[model samples]
Target: MPQLPEDMVLPEGFVPSQAPQPPAEPRDSATVALVRDTDGGPEVFLLRRVLGMAFAGGMTVFPGGGVDKRDADTSVAWAGPTPAWWARAFGCSAELARALVCAAVRETFEEAGVLLAGPDADSVVADATPYADARQELVERKLSLAEFLTEAGLVLRADLLRPLGNWVTPPEEPRRYDTRFFLAALPTGQRADGSTTEADHAAWQRPQDAIADWAARRSGLMPPTWVTLSQLAEHRSVRELLAAERQITKITPRVVRRNGNLHVALPGDADYPEAS
Candidate 1:
């Protein structure tokens, strides 16, 4: 790893000062932890994004990504909470926050094959496989989030998502996301099985087990990911974790390079594992 200039600091995001505008570009993202109650404790879904992807490649992550422009539409029916409450949840403008949560739910549906919506979650997901396929195309700009949500008869469960954390990639990484993390219980009858193309594999694992694997170097986790999962392991139940989120007053994370590793410093001084 190369050492950063002692006096130089990188911007939080990248922008080409001079280049043709891209027809489509990556926006900041919102992601979530699909948690479920287990006798052992709260388990969360995890996916290993394909190594070929530009960002966070080959790493285990909770399902999530950037806000889609179509997510801004106010018409997306939400079953859980009001938009104002959602705004406060994600700590952004009401419109932007609503979009982030909506995108989170939508992305979860797209990536994990689980819907936090519909009258019957199991049936909704079963019926949604085709739309889910379309949402995947949205990533490639073949379709839009608005079209996917409307045509599929799916409601974006913005209320179900509880803001948990926010992180941005370090300066050195070419790809970055000012990502907001949300937490929600796994919708009943819906399971999180990831697509093999974008993700190598997926599973629902206890947060502690996930962290322990990372700490033991058994599972690959970047620094930010390591700490986030560790913090999630503190609570023994999903209800308790949800309660804890209500008391959260901050989600600012610091990106840095140390000891040959990129790190995301969270509140209380925890960090995700970065490469050396």
Candidate 2:
């Protein structure tokens, strides 16, 4: 578990008028850890969310968002692993597993300019730049992933994704998400563009380099991103990283008081290194 920051301090003379509101419902979402091998080491793609966003603003994170209703559209063309396979992998219902996989692929294309879909079960889009218009439509919610794939005759490559873990937002947050994390290799010939409106900038950085940036306060990383990078930093190549087995577990932070200061605590508090 990652270390949590101290609780916010309220201004003097500020009194609560009503009891605290319950935490927002946790929305079903998916995030992708897009990685590739480079001369230095394996690098992961990251996006700095626009500061004005409602959640995790200005934080470096993986490309992902809430699952769209259309993600569950069973008609979408798909190749590779079946929804049932993903269901078992993610411990989700088959129906939701389909939506999660679709959401993962869709969000990756919309946010990172990488399409995990191909013309057929075996062919992936060598270059995704040609589909900029479709990508925009998807971002705008004007185009459903199912519709885009059907019109373009593409198949969702579920085989390209590997489940890493799941995370649920802490109850203290006003907006929450039950997000699933996935690992995927950047497709051949496709370049990730940092053109999404939601992000001020995006790029690929080696795991250790990103951690160093965070330590220097040059980049902001949420607990999940920080911990994930730390784990990935141990691997020198994407192949080795992916070949390792991961036992997925859910981690939720809880409020605790220590030394007269309120702070969030996660599992293994005494041994867990602080990432905040």
Which candidate achieves the best lDDT against the true structure? 2
lDDT of each: 0.68, 0.83
Pairs clashing in candidate 2? none
- Candidate 1 stretches with Cα past 4 Å from truth are 1-26, 120-141, 247-276
lDDT of 1 at 27: 55
Q: How close to the true structure is residue 9 of candidate 1, measured as C-alpha lDDT? A: 27
Model 1 pairs in collision = 29-65, 29-66, 222-273, 223-272, 223-273, 223-274, 224-272, 260-276
Query: What range of 10 consecutive residues in model 2 has the weakest lDDT sum?
Result: 10-19
Q: RMSD to the native, candidate 2?
A: 4.2
TM-score of model 1 relative to the true fold? 0.76
Residue by residue across 1-276, what tens digits does model 1's lDDT show?
A: 112223222233422333223313335788888899999999999998888687766779988877877778777756677778766765668888778877887778778877766643223343445555675776676766666667767666555667787666543343556777788887666667786467888998998898767656566775556657877888899888877844334333445555644444444443432431
TM of each candidate vs. truth: 0.76, 0.89
TM-score for model 2? 0.89
Model 2 error, position 255 (Å): 4.0
